[model samples]
Every structure is written in structure tokens, then in C-alpha cells.
Target: MPKLTIVAFDGTKFELDVASGSTVMENAVKNSVPGVEAECGGACACATCHVYIDDSWSEKVGAPDVMEEDMLDFAYEQKPTSRLSCQVKMTDDLDGLVVHVPERQA
Candidate 1:
């Protein structure tokens, strides 16, 4: 399992133990972390799971693909490091991954 640190717009931090191979959205929903709505589940069709990858983890998480990039346009306050949590899979290498949830989702 890999650990993830999810930071909320209000600066709350949730340290979660997430299962490998699961998406960040899955972990958030399962743990009831606020700001991650995941309205379409893990599907890339929605932007409710939007989040900002921590600067330190940006390169590791990489850039979003074309479809994901398009979807992100629908998110609130998008940033260079913005990513749809549903598209971010968990792995051992992301053990200390950190993401910031915006004040609101699209």
C-alpha cells in the first residue's frame, strides 16, 4: 500500500493509506476525504475529482493526457499541476504523494 497526503482548500491534511493500483479518487471517496466528489466514479468523463498535485510530486505524477486535459478545463481554478484524481493511479513510487483539493469542484 502507498500512503497519500491530501490537502484541502482549508489546509486540512488527510494522511491516507491507499491500495496500490487504485486511483486517487477511489482513495478519497473511500476515506471520505472532502472536496473529491468523484461523481462519475473513476471515469474520466467528469471533473469532480479534480486536484492539484503538489509541486514536489508533479513530475512523478506527470502531465495529464489530451482527454484528461480537456476535462480539466471544466474544473474550478485549474492550475499547471492540476489533474483529475480518477486518472491518477496509486503505486509504491507514490507512497508520499500529496494533492491539494480546490475550494470547490466543477
Candidate 2:
């Protein structure tokens, strides 16, 4: 299992022990973490699950693919580290990943 930290817009942190191959949006939706709307249900059809990758873990998580990158353009407060949580698959290499939910969805 890997540790995933999701910081809500209001600064609350939901620390989760996630299985490899699970997605950040899945865990957040499962645990009821606020601010991660996940409206598309991990289908990458929407930008409601947008989040910012923490600087420290950005390199390991890598950049979003072309599709996700295109979707992120609709995310609120999009930035250099913006990513769609659904597209971020958990793996052993990303054992300690951190993401921050934006104040609102697209």
C-alpha cells in the first residue's frame, strides 16, 4: 500500500493508505474528502476531480497525458502542477503522494 495525502481547500488533510493501481479521485470520493467533486467518476470526462500535485512529489507523479492536460484547462485555479486525480494511478514508485483540492470545480 501507498500513502496518499489529500489536502482540502479549507486545509483539512485526509491521509489514506491506498492500494497500488487505485486512483487519487477514487480514494477521495470513497473517504468523503471535501472539494474533490469527482463528477465524472474517474472517467476523465470532466475536470471536477482536479487537484494540484505537491511540489515534492510532482517529479515522481510525472506530468499528465495529453487528454488529461486538455481537460485540466477547465479546472479552477489551474497551475503548473494541475492534474486530474482520476488519471493519476497509484504505484509503488509513488508511495507518498500529496495533492491539494482546489476551492471549486470547473
Candidate 3:
């Protein structure tokens, strides 16, 4: 399992133990981590699961693929690091992954 550190817009922080191979959105919704709506249930059809990957971990997380890039266009407060959580699969290398939840989703 990998640990995910999420920071909410209001500054709340949550550390969740995520199972490998799961998507970040899945764990967020399952754990009730506020701000991740996951409106499409990890289908990548919505930007409700939008998040900003921490600067320190950005390279490791890598850039989003074409589909994810197109989907992020609908996310609120989109940034260079913005990513759809549903497209971020958990793995051992991402044990300390940190993401910031925006004040609102699209």
C-alpha cells in the first residue's frame, strides 16, 4: 500500500493508506476526503476529481496523457500541475504522493 497525503482547500490535511493499483480518486471517495467529487466514478468523464500534484512530486507523477489533458480543461483553477485524480493510479513509487484539492470542482 502507498500513503497519499491530500490537502484540502481550507487547509485540512488527510493521510490515507491507499492500496496499490487503485486510483487516487477511488481512495479519496472511499475515505470521504472532502473536495474530490469523482462524479463519473473514475471513468475520466468529468473533472470533479481534479487535484494539483505537489511541486516536489510533480516529475515523479509525470504529465497527464492526451485524454486526461483534455478532461482537465474543464477543471476549476486549472494549473500546470492539475490532474484528474481518476487517472492517477497508485503504486509503491507514489507512497508519499501529495495532492491539493481545489475549493471547488468543475
lDDT of each: 0.95, 0.93, 0.94
Candidate 2 lDDT at 82 equals 93
TM-score of 2: 0.97
Tell me model 1's lDDT, rounded to 2 decimals. Answer: 0.95
lDDT of 1 by residue, 1-106 (tens): 8999999889989999888999999988988898999999888999999999999999999999999999999999999999999999999999999999999999
Best-to-worst order by lDDT is: 1, 3, 2
Q: Tens-digit lDDT track for model 3 on 1-106?
A: 8999989899998999989999889988988889999989998899999999999999999999999999999999899999999999999999999999999999
Ten contiguous residues minimizing lDDT sum, candidate 1? 26-35
- For candidate 3, the 10 contiguous residues with the lowest summed lDDT are 23-32
Each model's TM-score?
0.97, 0.97, 0.97
In terms of TM-score, how similar is model 3 to the real structure?
0.97
Instruction: Give me the runs in candidate 3 sitting further than 4 Å from their true place.
Output: none
lDDT of 3 at 101: 96
Please list all clashing residue pairs in model 1, or write none if there are none: none
